[model samples]
Target chain A: MALELLKERWSSAINVLKVGAVKEEGGTRASAITVGGQTTLPFLLDEGGMPHRPVVAMEIFDVAPLEWPVSLLEPFGDAVKDPVKWAKKCINEFKADLICLTLKGTHPEAENISADKAVELVKNMLKEISTPLIIIGSGDKEKDNDVLARCSQATKGENCLFGLAAQDNFKTLVASCMADDHCIIADSPIDINIAKQVNILITDMGFKPEKIAMHPSTAALGYGMEYVYSIMERSRLAAFVGDKMLAMPFIIFVGQEAWKVKEAAANVADEPGWGDERMRGPLWEAATAVAMLHAGADILVMRHPEAVATVKRSIDSMMKGNND
Target chain B: MLVIGELINGMYQNVEQAIKTKNRSIIHKLAKEQLEAGADMLDINAGPHGADPKETMRWLIETIREVTPAPLAIDSTKLDVVELGLKLAGEGSMINSTKADDEKLDIYVPLAKKYKAKLIGLTMDKKGVPRDKNVKCELAAKILAKCMEMDLPLEDVYIDPIVLPVNVAQAQCAELLDVLREFKLISDPPPQTVVGLSNVSQGTKQRSLINRTYLVMAVASGLSGAIVDPLDKELMDAMITAELLLNKNIYCDSYIDAYRKR
Candidate 1:
């Protein structure tokens, strides 16, 4: 029997952001990633059509030391000491589709690496890995811009994700990425209006929509993650249901957040029979990533090799379902 | 503007009777007429109306999906009901609601992900209905934050700032318009701003007139879509006029054709 169909319409569509650089002559990486290509809401392939499935990118830090949950830190114990080695482990062992390098040491209190040091770390990661890279600053707006500026210049042609373009200080960050012709993370402080506003700001700066990835922000599972999930789902639905302006592919900072929560960080000793922190932590991250995937997250920034593998397997299964 | 026909809800006595009888014909007729009248989607709401809402919602969504392609808006405050409805419906569906409240967000958002459906977010949180438009905006921001966390694309969200009764508060319409405008200004990929469209007409004389007038104003204030009676020619006409005035629809060569044909 033929299933009757319902026509869906939109109030306003959310813009979709593309993930990678195309097989262009511009970036230094072998290729770029693209997400958020929807003519209809996410997963409405039969109703309208989905041009791209969300992608998964692994997370790597420039100077990995201190503050990482032990579960994540233990897996790559020695590799955690070396950025290049860690990047290799992520791609080779973890099968990461892409690598996101967070310049944590560039902050005021951390190692406080100079702009040149930041660039060197990024350059090292790029040399060590073939997948596309996403470069983020350590949350310090000024320091972020400085390091991102140099990193963007240094990784010119690689199409890396430069410093997150926050509302207040996106000017320098955006400028740096533009100068080196790199992709950027249009980061917002968990507000849909601000996310759209930032996109408008970035586009107004003449940056292409396809070149930007909006991290609307992610919340760990068991910690308001569902709220984040719903908002992202709604945004994607509006865009695909018929709001072309917001139809850009979206990315999620899953690992950074998922790992921060007690469910993913604390041990059984701390929580009492919550199971092994080693397995539980990665599962928490994987579960969070998987849930977000269904909600239309195009790029997932994850940590822990096992979590990455688990998410990849799930994506493979989902794609198979989509294909059938 | 997309009008999601506001029928098939258990809140309405007729729909409740129809559901109890398992009257496929009544449900089919309701579905067919609304689709013909240009309802982009049919909102299948089976709220707790003194029966098993979950069971009733499941049946309604299944029965409705069997008849129409205008994707189902799984309307219910119950998670089990929404989950059942979403599973029973086809792709590209929308969950009728989750509110701005953190607890509500926690429940409804997971269901959205589980079902992979778009959702209608009510601006009223645990704090009750906010009288201030800025507060509504803040509520919307919180809702949007949840969307990001979920990785559900912002475009899939349809924000419905809780519409107060105009009879109770004459300035409600103006306040709603301000909230809707602020809603339009959210994120790079902003969620769709929608309203119940008839809530303001409650207790008013000449309901159709009041409803249509309020709808036009709402649309003018950046309301991209609404849940309304597509059967009402006046209401539909207001939509066309609103879209044209908003410049969302082109009037260049098809002005007469569009107006007369409608």
Candidate 2:
């Protein structure tokens, strides 16, 4: 008897979306990042094609972080005091594929930075680095609607990927992206149906389906990571099985979720048996990111340079197909 | 659930008059309304009154295609009329039905294969509707066997156990539901099950209530598709809720609105 192999072919594929634009395309970035365009499960090369490998976007905040632990902040040094230097280090030394700048200062509870100030910071960051950018607003819904819209206009031709478009507050951001020719990140809390509904709502507002990426929400490695993993797996399965509305590529904030968890944030004295705080912290973030890649994350927004390097190696190995 | 819109048939006075007078507006309006109401596919039928049923089907298909690219179900009992519709309907369309009889299967199965359309096999023959669940299952088994022999994919084959009106044949309604459950066990990849949902409420006073209840019951029994009036908002709501309960769709406060938009 001969050995038999079973392979399932899918009827549809994830829409391929390109983020950023170069000088010739009316953008200041050196190159655009392409994601999605997979017709099968992640790294199942024998069954179907995964044309673009998953990329990493290192996170930097517009305002200096007041809460980041010393272990996590040690690598960046004085760059942590300035957003432009932090973004430049992420692109030049950390070798990040893209820069994810969060406008935390614009939140009402924070510095309450004006939209004009946020736009000036974005312009300075763009001038400092040629890497594609992923700009997200502060968590406040009302504040984000105002700040993100202004940032979106300032970077009109840059074609940056904007973020956190929720079901209720997507209209302003969607209109901005439509006018400025940029991609969007749709946010959904761990529910597959809500993820789909958010995408539908954005598309209904005339946003092209191909240009939208999904953030199905994320969790730390030991803190309900399985929930985020399962939701993403189910979502990818739905896409492969021809659900057009659920077929956008996934964007996960591995660093934001992982670093907040105590396992990654606790000091060595707090838990002696868990190994060194510095090693455990970055490893925890890296592990969460790698796990997300297996669950079909097209782009991972991570913190910590060490964790980013570790995840980049994993992505390289996974992109080598089944030969290894 | 696959909601096949059943409003385009010439059996309806408006549709019949439109077909006789070649009024594209009425047919076009029905087609658009059914689709907007969340019909996965439209069922096209030329009733007995049309002198040239083939011509009527062509016109109906052409009129619908001009408006939307949604898939059509070429529905008719006549083989020639169905063949004509299939030829003009393009791909992703379905043959409304063929019987469980071998002679009908021998012709209709190949016709379906040739046209690359799905086949709906009714689990009844010259003996008419089966009297019990066991007999219906046997007929369904026969249809599955024929589909396998003809190399027609079972996934594309829909087995209808035939619904009986509640006002007349009340006892058979339960029997029909049982037959739908049994149909799943007939093959490794079971054939999809569908029913003309309106049949269960024929001549009943609370037609809408009976039809909605029976449709939900049928869905619980693994009925994958149905031919119903999509324009009935309450009926569509009940069907959507049934699917949500089955965990086919995730629950949200505006799940009904989300489903409609999808």
Candidate 3:
């Protein structure tokens, strides 16, 4: 009866695809990440149903990232210099459910690293971090295809999420995902049409539909955040009804994009009387992540240990079964 | 002004039976009721009911066409069902689903072009339903791409992201409004945003009340057409109110006229 009631209340519990085959089931990875499967938007316990708590992935960089604003520097001081150390700090200190390692340095311009160099870093990341890992590109389309393809093979049995499958190059990423039996981040710009187009393109390649964790694009709060939030929310709605094709779980790069902006990372005198940069920055990231969660973001690729902690607490509290 | 009469669907068992029996009497009655209730087109769905969907669809379409000149909305998941129904519809028919899936378009675009029929594209693709509004729009664009590729006119592409249930998916309503706003801005001629309004109230109490309220909001958010029952008085009233609020009707005057006619 409770199950029936839950089903009735949550008319459309969005289907969350569970990626990776466990050794218990067939593959590696100690456990798997379950995204989607939400009956309501974030934190509406009384009205709708909540399924699979939102998963938080702490961001790790391939190389010591130079562009991280100084305000964010203090938290990961020495760890920033070492990718494995950064993943350790993210898992142990930050208590991240998953770790997202951005292959930002693999960009032809970022670090100009070879595919072997990229593979070595991923090998170290997989060895160092026990949590599920998501490997992202350096935001360069062509470089990502070549590098992520190599990373996919390097992390073959790990069920990692290769951090992008764009509309133009999803075919290559899909092939890599198929070969590696891994998941992909179906990332698109802020347009809903582009996001769906990418997903359609990926599936059209004969890849497993559940393996695609669509990134509907995230915008920092002050800078067109509402637009991004609204788009994510609408995509969730389309999934529930009779539309079978669009029912996949969604991924949001909650921390990386939302936190890097000046509004989120700016310190004292930077924005004049804008409080403590430390508190303000994580809060901005958390707020953005929370808003996207409400907009039906299943997986949040976040940064900032404190922000990750806060967002996890919120998810836990929101998911405490509305039967109360 | 393009009111797609979403009556006569298999979701309701009576209609399902009527379609199965090829009961011209019941089918004819429903069609005339919708026409009288100001429906511009009548949507016919045999759905997943335990009936020969194709035959039921053909029967429903043929019977409705014989009774009223209202254009047909060939509603079905099966591409062939839509194709067969379109062939049966003769002219000025509307295909109910061309999903964001390119495979669907592989079938729908050609059928639509061949029949010169208007097509409704469900804003979902091969990966299935998207939970984000942007993805829905992206799906719409993908479907539009297939339409454009086939030289199908943009005006004939009616996009339905398929409205989310509000009580269950609370943020869904707000998200849909956002999608509607973006859809208005991004679409070339802006393929019309149609919705199955009844689904919004599927599991809720005072469903008519919820559906009517949402209908007002949806229409205001540039919903060009809706797959809604023309028979529900409350829904009809909400549509009139929405038209007035949007000034699609010049004042409350049209509302009064519509109400009086009813």
Candidate 4:
């Protein structure tokens, strides 16, 4: 008797989203990246098609970090002090596919920079690095509305991806992205229904579905990571089963979530049983990224040079259909 | 669940008056309201309204198509009326039904295939509705076999295991649910299952309550579609909750709102 492989066919495919546009297409990036468009579940090529491999976006802040551990701050050296140097080092040395510029300095409790200052930093970052940018606002909702609108206008035609548009605060981001020809990140708090609802609300505001990405908020390893993993799995399954509202590509913040956990951030002397802090931290981040990739993450906003290399290699191997 | 809005049928007095006067506004309003309430398809029936059934069907379809392109179920007992509606409504329409008999299948099966329309097969013959669950399954198997022999894709076939009013045939209600469960076993990729949901509550005082409770139970028994009044908010909410509980949809606090939007 011959072996008969059972294959499940899906009725729909995930929508493909382009992150950036090159100069000929009215953007200054050297090249653009396309993600999503998977006809099957992640890395299961025997059943269907996964046309594009998942890409990594390295995270940078507009202002220097005051809380990063020694293991994390050591890799960037003095580049951490300057956003342009940090972005260039990420693209030139670490080969990051994208740069996620978080405007944390604009928060009221932080440096409390004005929208003008945020726009200046964005302009400087765009001038230095030809890589695509993912610009996000500070956590302050009222301040983000003002700062992101200014930044979005300053980066018109660049087609950068903007972030953190939740259910309650998506109108401003939607209008900005609509006017600027950029993509948006629709965030939900680990609930698949809210995830879909946020997408619906954004689309209702006339933002094109192809220009939207879903951010089901991330969780680190051993700290409710499975919740996020399962949510992404269920979401991808829903998209494959022809739920148009949930059919957008997923963009997860692996570095931001993973690095905040004690397993990845605690000092080695504090927990002797857990190996060295340097190796343990990067491995924790790398494991989280790989797990998310398997759960159908199309774009991972990651940090740590070593973790980025590991995840990139893993994506290459997975795309090659290697089972070993 | 594939909710087929049951408001456009001439059996309703309002629809009968609309069909009699050729009132496009009345029919158009019903179509829009049902769709807005989340009907995946519309069921158009020209009941005994003393008008030319073919003309009434054509007028209903044309009026509704002007408002929206939602799929229509060309519902009628007359073969000529069904054939005319099928021709005018174009592809993606459904034959509201045919009895599980060779004579009826021979005509409806070919017409459905030629028109690229779905065919709904009721599990009953000229002898009348089956009293036992096994007999209903036997009739369903006959319908499935006929569809297979005639080269129609089973995916386009919906097996309706005839629901009777609880006031008249109370014993058959449970049996019909069993038949729905058994219908899946008759084929590899089972044919879709549907029910005329309002039939179960005829002459009942608590019509909405009965209809919704029975709908949830039928959904649990693998009912894939229902012909119901989508405007009934409570009934539609029950259907949405049942699907969510079955893991057919992901849960959020505002799932009812989400389903209506979808």
Which stretches of model 3 miss by more than 4 angstroms? A1-13, A46-48, A321-324, B1-262
Name the better of 2 and 3 by lDDT: 2
RMSD of each: 19.2, 2.5, 19.2, 3.4
Q: Write the per-residue lDDT of candidate 1 for residues B1-262, one digit (tens) a residue.
A: 6578997787888888888888888888889888777687889888566568878877887687677767888877777777788888867888888888888898787777767788888888767888888888888888888988988777778888867668888887888887777776777656688888778878888789988988888888878679988778778877777786776533423332233322
DockQ of each: 0.02, 0.28, 0.02, 0.37
Lowest summed-lDDT stretch of 10 residues in model 4 chain B?
B253-262
Docking level for model 2? acceptable
Residue range A1-324, candidate 4, lDDT tens digits: 999999988989999999888989898999888999999999999989999889999999989986998898899999999999999999999999999999999999999999999999999888888988999999899999999999999999999999889999999988999999999999999988899889888887889989999999999888888999999998889888867788899999999999999999888899999989999999999999999999899999998999999999999999999945
lDDT for each residue of candidate 3 in B1-262, tens digit (9 for 90 to 100):
4778887888787787776666789888989988787787888888686547887777777788788876888888887788898888878899988777767788888888899999988887768778888888788778877888889988888888778787778888789888887887666667777888888888888888887888888788788888888888768877877765665432322333433232
Ranking by lDDT: 4, 2, 3, 1
lDDT string, candidate 1, A216-299, tens digits? 789888988888877776556545434333455677899888887887899888888798999999999999998888777888
Identify the leading candidate in terms of TM-score: 2
Better of 2 and 4 by lDDT: 4
What are the Cα lDDT values of the candidates?
A: 0.76, 0.90, 0.77, 0.92
Q: Which CAPRI quality tier does the interface of model 4 achieve? A: acceptable
Please give the interface root mean square deviation for model 3, in Å: 16.2
Error of 2 at A247 (Å): 3.2
The candidate maximizing DockQ is 4
lDDT of 2: 0.90
- Fnat by candidate, in order: 0.00, 0.25, 0.00, 0.38
Here the TM-score of candidate 3's chain B is 0.92
Q: Please give the lDDT score for candidate 4.
A: 0.92
